[model samples]
Target: MEKHILYTTEAVNQDGLNGQSFIKTGGLTVTVSNPLNNKPGTNPEQLLGLSLSTCMNATLQAIEREHGLAHTAEVRVTVTLIKEENFAFLVVARVRIPGVPLKTATKLVALAKKRCPVSKLLSGSSYYQVQVVEDY
Candidate 1:
């Protein structure tokens, strides 16, 4: 199979978790800070959760539209940073599709998990999971 490039963007983080991170395109910038601290900034865990939740929900919306259903999917991503022998993150994406049956929602989530770029990037890790839930 041939690979075709669609769109690309670059993000630069200069001071790790203590300063700022911005897009090379100059569109967005975010203050970075350690989650353990009380500083008002965004941490990696929160950023990861946002990315997964947004990507998964967007994918679910597209699938729902294709099936002639209204956009009613909600995705909640919980990211936990664990420290043992090494630092690892446990990511769980909880998805709820209101007005849709459990079976159908489950199928839609499964498909979204496969289609979402963030989900695919994390799918190989045992710490990542996507589940269909009755409530958001």
Candidate 2:
């Protein structure tokens, strides 16, 4: 079996309706922002939306370079949650590839869906491994 290294994130913040959620890693900063909840950070829903598109678009970008396809793609992912319905969250990923044939775009989208890391994670192909070590 091929082995893959995993990563982790440690998020720290305050409690209650107003607090900040910031992640610090490798000289990078990510803030979770939700004004309504008084949270100065991106909530889970927003994160999910970003993740899906990020993955899909990254894959498309890679394919574009590999295939020598000269076209910029506009990717938009919509995530909806209906409490009354049985399905909780539905993610619709749309890609607008200019100068690319419709049939070719469709095929690339399918391939990207299979290759994107976030897509794989959302599809349940990848999972998180959590380990807690006691420090006393």
Candidate 3:
């Protein structure tokens, strides 16, 4: 598989406060709220919150399927941002898995941390390239 796969989505309603965006897949709807920051776009903090929740949820599902156990997994993500000297965000995730063995839960958490796409991306270093285009 290509490391840099291309994923595309469309956004309309540019006049809204956050450019209301939503994607429809199958029978589900996913919406993103524009963060009220200076950038006036989807904030990284919100995306981080989503990513962490997704990873932890997948791990719980894997454990349930493998062990034939039933439980609800509630993930709480707290994000802190520092924008004074430099821009930074800290995401702390607390996963609640009831009726699961401590060791098994730990294993699942570790595996999820390793396998989650967002976790992997955040763990590695990233930089953005910017370019300015002019109309011909």
Measured by lDDT, the strongest candidate is: 1
Candidate 2 per-residue C-alpha lDDT over 1-136 given as tens digits, one digit per residue, 9 for 90 to 100: 9978797777556643244555655443456554345646656566677877777788889988788987576677776655654635666677877777777777777777778877777665222211111210
Tens digits of per-residue lDDT, candidate 1, 1-136, equal 9999999999998899999999999898999999888999998899889999999999999999988999999998999999989998999999989999999999998999999999999989999988889975
In candidate 3, what are the lDDT values of residues 18-84, reduced to their tens digit?
A: 4444443333233435454565455547766876777667766776677777756566676767576
Candidate 2 error regions (>4 Å): 6-8, 11-18, 24-41, 85-87, 124-136
**lDDT score at residue 133, model 2, on the 0-100 scale:** 15
Error of 2 at 75 (Å): 1.1
Clashes of each: 0, 4, 0
Q: State how far residue 45 of model 3 sits from its true place (Å).
A: 1.9
lDDT of 3 at 37: 54
Give the CA lDDT, 0 to 100, for residue 105 in model 2.
76
lDDT of 2 at 76: 78
In model 2, pairs of residues that clash are: 32-41, 32-42, 33-41, 33-42
Off by over 4 Å in 1: none
Ranking under TM-score, best-scoring first?
Answer: 1, 2, 3
lDDT of 1 at 90: 94
Off by over 4 Å in 3: 1-43, 125-136
lDDT of all predictions: 0.93, 0.65, 0.58
